[model samples]
Target: MKKRAIQILLALSLIFYKSTWFWRVFNHLAKPYLPASREFFQILLLMESGVLFLAVIY
Candidate 1:
């Protein structure tokens, strides 16, 4: 049950990370602090997705 719940949350987070509106707001907030905010966000998303995928598999 616990693992299943974690898998569900990871799936939800994967979906959330793919949303444009969420990134728009994230970039808007992070742009001032980071010069290459979009690139950083993309890398972060990729890493997050990888971790989530591995978690779901294991």
Candidate 2:
């Protein structure tokens, strides 16, 4: 069950990876709480996706 949820989340992130509007909205919403700029957040998300990929593999 947990693995399934992780897989679904990874899939969604990958699907939205190419959509600029998706990132824009996320950046806007997260701006106040997180100090990360758009580019930094994008990189952070990519790193998270990589971790999720590894988790799914193992």
Tell me the spans in candidate 2 whose CA falls farther than 4 Å from its real position.
1-24, 30-36
Every model's TM-score? 0.51, 0.46
lDDT of 1: 0.75
- Maximum-lDDT candidate: 1
Residues 1-58 of candidate 1 have per-residue lDDT tens digits of 9988878787867667675666888878887888676787788877877776776767
TM-score of 2: 0.46
Residue 46 of candidate 1: its Cα lDDT?
73
Alpha-carbon lDDT, every model:
0.75, 0.72
Error of 1 at 8 (Å): 8.7
- As for candidate 2, its clashing pairs are none
